[model samples]
Target chain A: MDDPEYRAGIIDLLGALAVGELTAFQRLAADAELAPTRADQAALAGMAVAEFHHFEQIRDRLTELGVALDDAMTPFHEPYVAFHANTAPSNWLEGLVKAYVGDQIATDFYREIAATVDDDTRALVNDVLAEAGHADFVVDRVRAAIDEDPSVAGRLALWGRRLVGEALAQAQRVAADRDALTAIIVGAPGRPGMDLAELGQVLSRLTENHAQRMAKLGLSS
Target chain B: MDDPEYRAGIIDLLGALAVGELTAFQRLAADAELAPTRADQAALAGMAVAEFHHFEQIRDRLTELGVALDDAMTPFHEPYVAFHANTAPSNWLEGLVKAYVGDQIATDFYREIAATVDDDTRALVNDVLAEAGHADFVVDRVRAAIDEDPSVAGRLALWGRRLVGEALAQAQRVAADRDALTAIIVGAPGRPGMDLAELGQVLSRLTENHAQRMAKLGLSS
Candidate 1:
């Protein structure tokens, strides 16, 4: 039973997710200049396209749960928008790390939260997370860039750290601003969602993938 | 014969076209937000994806002509970037009009310039301009928006005008900077390319379609 408290948390998270996708779409598209060839540009465009697919899942789930998409999303826009405006990547490798580290973390959070919802919402979130594709493209691009210039490693690693710190800061804002949602997610298991332990496990998995990816790109995580 | 002047105009124009496709790709992905439903948003995304196809064509031509795609495009980035940076649409409808009106006029210019090239380049340009596969989608969306809210008509009409005017201003700059290429087009009949008069008529036809489309959307000159 999604009482107002829990519903608010889900809405808070979903709102953040929607805005994140919107911002990512803008970044990926703008970042097409980082691409070396027309084919590479199209590949980034494909990744940008995938973000919309994720957006559809989150937006539809919100609509079905009786939250107006815009209204639910309106509150979370400012902080997240400010975060992106400040941290806009200045180069190709920076952009790739932003996409790779940031999206994989967001996906982890969404998956953790999804396990706490009802069957329907779980299905929708699961479906969206299932399409979790394209990080490989980011990894490939970063690895190529790093291969060409080993010096890019240090800069990109630092950029990745900055993005994660900002993401966690804002994510905390999202979780704290809506206690009901946070409580529901934190107190899941028999109630309806994944408990905190399960959530951590999922996060661990996401982080491992990120670490491995960075190492593949010749960067120390 | 193929010379720097001939290439200067054509190259400037081609570079501008590549930028347009790149920008269009980014904008369509961003504009997917303007759609009301998942299907519509996905449709908008599909529309944006097609720009990459045209983008690849232009890049290939640039490569064949021994021009570095980025180098050919370097000079105009600030001006064109300033143009889009200033005119970003806040909603779905504005985004649609931009795609519809802005792209339509661009297609007109592409068609005209394609004709001014040699049979080979003209053939390639024709392939690029061939009916602008997204025109129908833009028209449908514009009409639907107007149908939903007639008030949208007046504003969109003005917006359409502004898009065209801004584009024309940029077009003049592209032309002035690439006079040699312009000469090739305007002087192609006697050179290795096609006829300029034929290009003028082709441009007229494209413009006719644009006007008809505007009227269909309840927009006007």
Candidate 2:
């Protein structure tokens, strides 16, 4: 937070997160409509509402920093928007899997990146990530769904892999596009950045966690 | 609150409100996508999130009453779904107009209905309806849009009318189908309900308020 580059990187990260949450709120609300039952709809809507609150917190932080929210968020909007557009769920199960897997990946990325930021920002990020109750709800729904129809697991697992691929591709694009933001993560002067080896470890951990999540949902990732 | 008839009516009212908020949450999120700018999108999403919270509160209240939420909300779902389907906005301005006009009518209806229920239920319904800041945001957007193109106001005014028409029709259908709920508003044992003259007065008040809202938007109702 001291260095200008570090600050810009932090803003970029938060902006991306805010926009991601905003869109997630929209997509999840839309997805809730696809649920066959009112209970399922309410569960997904609850998750979407949680995401909306997170977005508000991050956006308020940006405003407190005297940044124009749109300007701060503009650079990162396209990539996240494209990610959602490219991975629009085809059915209710796909929507649930997307919500579950997509949120975990984002939370994992946030946690990894939080380590390089200042204490305050790290705390904020951690608070957002710690709201994990919704994940279990999604997991239970997905597991129950798969239990009812085992054949669908294969398609959903494929959907899960596609989500990961699209997410990583978008992440790379954002990193390449925003040098300052990338510097915050990969290393810049006066900023604690991840080294090549550490980066590899992070990726391995993310992939392993994703695999475990898919397996937990009775899917073969 | 103690009478079974009163309790059943309260449950039905809360159930309808819950489903209304759920569908409103969905529709507003979809409407947010039509926003021309990030700020507008965020504003609408904020509105959607508020609706989600209200849904949760009403759902919880129903659960407290030993009513299964899905069963309570299911009957009201179809009418709301049909209403939204019939009045889906064609653009950003129309969306804004819809949000503004639709919310006011719903709030007005809630206030009228709140008068008949017990104090506790009245307070809960009033709390849900009292969230008013989003209206100002929406009003500003609608007025600004009208300023940009006067002709657009004509289109939006018509859109607003269609929304009210569709809303009233569906509400009538719901009232006809759910006699217990309707009885609470029209008349119930020991429940001070609206007489014919009072009902006419309520209708006039609703229409007058809607017209004033339209005029505030620089539109002829």
Candidate 3:
């Protein structure tokens, strides 16, 4: 807590997460427009609302820490915007897969990072990562779509792969730009951080979880 | 409560309100993109989420009464879609005014109808009508924009009028299509309903409030 570098790292982490949630809200709400039925639209809108609530929580936390909400969020804005622009879904099913696979991968990454943060920050991260209870809705719709037209599965599976690839690209860009954030993950003087082996394990775990999520959607990773 | 016609009217009212909230969520969320700043975007997104929450409440009420949620909402869908399509804001300021003026008008109409419903329905209607606390945000922004560029006011004022006009046109269409909803307002035998004079008063009040809202936003109605 006394370390200036650690405090800076925590701020960067919170900022990144806050912006992530905000963009997720925007993207999901936009995707809801592509929904085939009003019921599906409502479901996607519910998820968007949940993301906005999570964004509010992180915003409040940032405010409590004496950080300007906009200042904390601005640095990560480009990365998130670029990611969404590059991976914008062409249709509703692609949007569903992006919401499902993309969000879970981010959640898994944040959960891992949460392990390395202070108790208070860890709790906040975990709390926000808690699913909005719509995974089954996404899974159900995606699976039913595939069942009805097995041919679409190939294109969707490729979309899933593209989502993860773009997410990682944006994340790496953020990590490269924010040394304080990477320091928190990889270690600084007098700080506990993941060693190379442990970092490999984290990446492995993230990949494994991504594959499982793809499978859950009845798509190959 | 035992009058089948009255029951049908109540369902129609709730259904109309539910679909209204649902579309409001979609419209607000869509309009959030036109926001010029991240703060503005978040503000609009917050309002959208609030509308969705209200939608959920009306939805549950409809379900508890054993009405199918989709069926209750379907009849009003076309009118809502048409209203939004016709009045879609041209830019961020237009979007804000539409949100503030347009939503207030809808709220005012529902409140008037609320006065004629059963106590339970009245409570729910009032509960959802309670503002999401962002009126001040919209008021401040629209007023600020007008102050910065006085020329925009005439255009915005015209936009506000168009919104109200489009809203009235859709309301009439809904009334014509849903006899039960109209019967609730105009009254059926053995049921209390608004007399023509009372209906005129309701319209006057709606208009007055709309003007007040427009004035608050530095626009004319």
The candidate that wins on lDDT is 3
> Each model: TM-score of chain B?
0.84, 0.96, 0.98
Worst 10 residues of 3 chain B by lDDT: B183-192
Displacement of residue A17 (Cα, Å) in model 1 is 3.2
Task: State each model's C-alpha RMSD to the native.
Answer: 5.9, 1.6, 1.5
lDDT, candidate 1, B89-153, per-residue tens? 88888888887777778877777666566577778777876665666777787888788988989
Q: Model 1 chain A — which ten-residue stretch has the worst lDDT?
A: A187-196
TM-score-based ranking: 3, 2, 1
What would the TM-scores of all predictions be? Answer: 0.68, 0.96, 0.96
The residue-by-residue lDDT of candidate 2 on B1-221, one tens digit each, is 76778777888999999998889989999999998878889998888888888888898888888889888999999999999999999898888888888988998998898988888899999998886588888878888777888888878878888999998999899988988898889987666788999999999999999999988888888
By lDDT rank, best first, the candidates go: 3, 2, 1
Q: List, residue by residue over A21-77, the lDDT tens digit for candidate 2.
A: 888888888889999888899999888888888888898899999888898888888
Which candidate achieves the best DockQ against the true structure?
2
Docking class of 3: medium
Better of 2 and 3 by lDDT: 3
What clash count goes with each model?
A: 7, 0, 0
